[model samples]
Target: MPMKKKPTNICCFLPDEIVENILHRLPTKTLLKYKIVCKRWKSLISSTSFKRLHENKSLENPVLILFSRQEGKPFLTTVDLSGAVLDRWDLASIGLQNSAFLPSPFGSDNLLCLVVDMQRFFVCNPSTRRACQICLPKASMHCPSGISKASFGYVPDRNQYVIVAKFKGRRNWRMITLSRDDVVVSAGNIDERWKIIKDSARYRVADGSPWGVFADGILYWTGDADDRRCLTCFDLWEEKFFVVLLPDEIVMIQEYQDDDQWLVELNGDLHLMYKKEGQQDIELWKLDGAGDWGWSKQDMCVAGFRARFGAHFRPVMMDEKGEMLVYNGGFMEWYKLKHEVFRMGGKGYKNIHCHAEDVILDFKLHIDTLL
Candidate 1:
């Protein structure tokens, strides 16, 4: 007997554990392509354990995900904080048509969550380009008044992705989820159905451009608080609401308008950005519980910022070196708060013209390695 000829299998030589270790580090694009190699490969890649492993590896290096609006269209791009484009993906190719695009893409465990015209929910893997549209449950159907605030977050305890919608009509709360396959469908069963949470507080999120910042399993929004505006905190784990007090100066300014105020989460702490009515200096306040209302203040100066400070420039983030990232619709640059100068000086700060003369720049911290 000729020993039945030694088997010849390229991928079969590696153990399942080794294969999973290598595949988890590969980009989503490559992994999707590899799924067609064989049934074993497909099953392995599609397994929940493999997905959890991939997500864990991806969390290592975070990138800056940019949503640039040009000519009323939205483009999704990823770049490192150092100002280098890594991957550029067109939203149109993924069925994101002429709909009203949400500002920044929300990051979940293994996917990025986006809203279309505030009517549809799209969860996609930025790396693999695999997307699934989640249908809004009937319970979450159009509110007579309107949808005041909507946000998507992941619950680690349940290992599920949830969309929390706050309606303006009855001031009600609707919690919706995607199916096991990640498709949006009307709640079919108890597990996949929408649950309404009764509202207890009189607090409400502001109307226009209310951005949701998810940090430490809680979603934070900048909204109204009686005559003064304040930070709204929603605990995803508890499904409860809490109000965070903004700096005295911030509350005073926000009471007037929303353009000048921004809520951002940096390095796990909530940050509030605001510029007094006539000050050239922009102050960034961080929640400093050890200090005051868990708030600490840092200021930055921009030349002629007061006269030119409309919506073009917004302070979005700060790095460990104390350099702040300033986004101006079309381009992003780092400003050394301590040095009082921008990385590119004046020329480096020049706007990278987009198709739309007026664009909105939204930044979501992305993990470079994950994609």
Candidate 2:
């Protein structure tokens, strides 16, 4: 009989291209866990090409990430639009305790930029559950409390993530910028320095969390002086500040208990959401760049909302299907366009009263991926 050769290991004989194709189809969590399977798998997963492929796949299946606290522990939970839980990443592991993270955290691509303890700054990839605490510049030490306004955004021109913060003191107002590297590296290896921006606008940053909307390389925040409302624009590239007067029809309504007004970015346009003085409906105004300084009114169906929640909820977002996501007393409620309302969280979520405000503070549409 002819000599038979021993059978070779199947996985060892697998080609690199074949292995990557199989791994690409797997979910992010599985790929992350599979990295420890072997050295080869780890090396394949950590490659730049594989990361780019994974990110493209992630964009197809986007998930809403809510920043909430459970039993005094701050946790980032990923959920489907139907309110089904997919995964939960405990932020406590990264030292974010007691919901200390700021609200309306600016998210671009796959990263979240948040402020912690009102002084220190950090950029986190919630999908990968990784965070790096960045150091503030030397100027912050002398005027720690001068950080009146701050936000994070991506600058395509520089191919970098820029952090914009406005500092106010007794004498002059200063705008600072910090450029974060695109590649992820150790916190120690990164330089978190602040550079002063030369501008003369003395607009105080509005709201506690990130109340600004970042669109087209510019960070916009609503500012008020002497009951006159205006939009504060910060050019990320030019590193300059300018103010635009808001339309007379739109008014800023303040909810003493919690903030009801919001600056939302929808379909690459800036929008403002607020309730009229005596109306039971929520109003939306979109900025019309075509016209010379004007905000066009948008018609939206809030009948289903007022029927159930009675104007107590805040409109979070509107999907392509015309379904609207809103927040009510800390509970997420989904209302179809001119349809009925469904409460996302079930009855066992009574502890939500204390954390409802915090939810809106730092929540954004977060995607789950290995970034």
Q: Which structure among the candidates has the greatest TM-score?
A: 2
> Which ten-residue region of model 1 has the weakest summed lDDT?
183-192
In model 1, where do residues sit more than 4 Å from their true spots?
1-26, 35-57, 69-73, 79-90, 98-110, 139-146, 177-192, 253-255, 289-293, 299-310, 314-317, 344-361, 368-371
User: Which candidate has the highest lDDT of all?
Assistant: 1
225 Cα displacement, candidate 1 (Å)? 2.5
Model 2 Cα displacement at 62 (Å)? 0.7
Q: What are the lDDT scores of the predictions, listed in order?
A: 0.63, 0.61
lDDT measured at residue 103 in model 2 versus the true structure, 0 to 100: 29
TM-score of 2: 0.78
lDDT per residue for candidate 1 within 274-299, as digits (tens), equals 66676555667777642245676866
Clashing pairs in 2: 103-361, 103-362, 104-361, 104-362
Q: Over the full model, what C-alpha lDDT does candidate 2 score relative to the true structure?
A: 0.61
